[model samples]
Target: MAFHLRPATDQDLPFARALTYEAMSGYYLQYGLMWSNDGFDVAWAGRENWLICNDNAVLGFISLSRDSRALYIRELHMLEACRGLGAGSWVLEQMALKAQALGVLRLTVFKNNPARRLYLRSGMRIVGEEHCFWRMERVCQSS
Candidate 1:
């Protein structure tokens, strides 16, 4: 199936928020926590959220915050049905390409996130850890 990854527009915000809930609720619920719609509302309004979709529906999503030197990936979630496929890796590749095009030197991922494996596999490495989150950096390779 053909899929596209693109910057989300305002019209996609509601779907994005619902996708966030679908992806995160399981994890949060494990810790007896849940995300409030108000919080998602605020995040959706403020962050750069990207959506992954095919002809059918949104398959995954990721959000990031960037500065002059780096982009911090705030959230990356693929639908339960899409896990174990290449969707997650595709999203990471897209993010790396975007970072490179923007001259960004690094991107960070949280410590316990399983997606850390994907980031590491894509050539990002741990540079530091704080407050239980690992910070990974992708140094541009010299060709």
Candidate 2:
């Protein structure tokens, strides 16, 4: 199935929340930690959330924060079915393009997340790791 990335709307909150919860639950199950809906809701409550959809079904979502110099990838989650299918790479490419357009220098990703492989493949490198997360950055080229 083909996937597309789009700016998330308020109407997409329910779907986004469900995907977030599912991803978190999987992580909790894998690591034996408690996953809470409140945590998901709070993380997505007021951020710039983007939806990865195909024919109206939400496949994944990502949230980001932007500063003058860089964009921080706050959260990214893809359904288990969508993992390893290039959907994650597509989303990261979109994010990188958006950052480049904004004249941002780089984007950041956490270390422990499996998505680190995607970031590295997309040319981001580990700059640091803190709080159990590996921070990565990719410099954008100027026009």
lDDT of each: 0.74, 0.73
Q: Write the per-residue lDDT of candidate 1 for residues 1-143, one digit (tens) a residue.
A: 67787778888777777877876666566656658989877877888888887766888777888887766677787877888778877777777777775554455544566778888887788888766567787765334
lDDT of 2: 0.73
- Going through the candidates in the order shown, the clash numbers are 1, 1
Compose the digit string of candidate 2's lDDT tens values, residues 56-125.
Answer: 8777888888887887787788888878888888777777787885554244443356677878898888
Worst 10 residues of 1 by lDDT: 101-110
Clashing pairs in 1: 111-134
Question: Least accurate stretch of 10 residues (summed lDDT) in model 2?
Answer: 103-112
TM-score of model 1 vs. true structure: 0.77
